[model samples]
Target: MQAQILNLMRELQRALGLTYPFISHDLAVVYYISSRVAVMYLGRICELAETAALVERPRHPYARLLLDTIPDLEMSGRDRAPVAGEVPSPIDPPPVCAFHPRCPHADARCRSERPELRPDGGAEVACHAVEEGRLP
Candidate 1:
């Protein structure tokens, strides 16, 4: 039923030349329905990019973690370590980057200064680690 609905939406999109702000937690569904993707953490856009590019090479730490949650059938045996810490409350989100608590690459700057969206390769990412070239 989900597949049928997605297919129908696609058909309508093409027939009517409509653009939809397709927001979904299902990465596969988002990839199928969206040309661009904006990854959010605590109500802030952490990264935005072409769907294919973001999937292929995620720039932000949170973006990478989100993509890692997707099951990769081809690499079923690979061991994946969960990101550390917990998501801060949205009502009282952390001062700096929302993902700092869980980010493996987070540093002092990430804890103190909020990052702004800046172009990095194919994506615009809001991450101190990405800005400092600390993350690959």
Candidate 2:
């Protein structure tokens, strides 16, 4: 199926000189075909950065959690901690940062007010703790 899809996309790209949008939760597939990446949580974009940068140095807590789940030689001997708690409903996200409820680094301000997407090094993150330099 993957082979067929790739062949079809190549054919379409050659015929029309246009690229097709591929959407999936599979990080591997996204990394393979995309030049940029947008990380989201609870219907909100938490981070947007170059694929390599985001994977190597994730700024958002949720993005870090997602990257940590990937199997890698660097983490061969270590146990990858699973992301905790259930995802909140997107239909009614929290008033503040939507990820605050599950974010281990969340502080008082994170619970009270929403954070804006701010540039952090090369990535953009919507985290109060990150903005205030509270995150270690």
Candidate 3:
């Protein structure tokens, strides 16, 4: 039923020359339906990229974890990496990068400074690592 609705939406999009924000928590579903993808951590948009590029090479640690979490039939025997850590409270969250608590790439700068979304390749990413050329 969902697939049918998505197909109809796609048809409508083509016929009407319009776009729809198809939101979902399932990374696989997002990859299947979205041309662009945005990853949010603690209500902040951490990364935005073309679905293909993001899936192939995620620029942010949180986005990488999300893509890695997608179940793959080809890698059925491989163990899944756990989602990093507990999410910080949304109420008056940290003053720094929101994902710093769980980000493996986070450093002192990330713990103290908030990153802004900036263009990198074909994406807009909010990570000190991406800005510092540590990740592409």
Estimate candidate 2's RMSD in Å: 2.5
lDDT of 1 by residue, 16-135 (tens): 999989878998899999999999998999999999999998888888888889988898686565878988999999878888888888888889999999999978999888888876
Q: What is the lDDT of residue 46 in candidate 1?
A: 96
Tell me which residue pairs clash in candidate 1.
none
How many residue pairs clash in model 2? Answer: 0
Q: Name the weakest run of 10 consecutive residues (lDDT summed) in model 3.
A: 75-84
Candidate 2 per-residue C-alpha lDDT over 1-136 given as tens digits, one digit per residue, 9 for 90 to 100 = 9868866776777799886566778898878766678898887889989888987788888888888877786656755555666677889888788887678887888889888899989888888877888765
Candidate 3 per-residue lDDT, tens place, 62-82, comes to 888887776686866855457
Q: Among all windows of ten consecutive residues in candidate 2, which has the lowest summed lDDT?
A: 73-82
TM-score of 3: 0.88
Better of 1 and 3 by TM-score: 1
Clashes in each model (backbone N, CA, C under 3 Å)? 0, 0, 0
What's the alpha carbon RMSD for model 3? 2.2
Q: What is the Cα-based TM-score of model 1?
A: 0.93
Ranking by TM-score: 1, 3, 2
What is the model-wide C-alpha lDDT for candidate 2? Answer: 0.81
Decoy 2 TM-score against native: 0.82
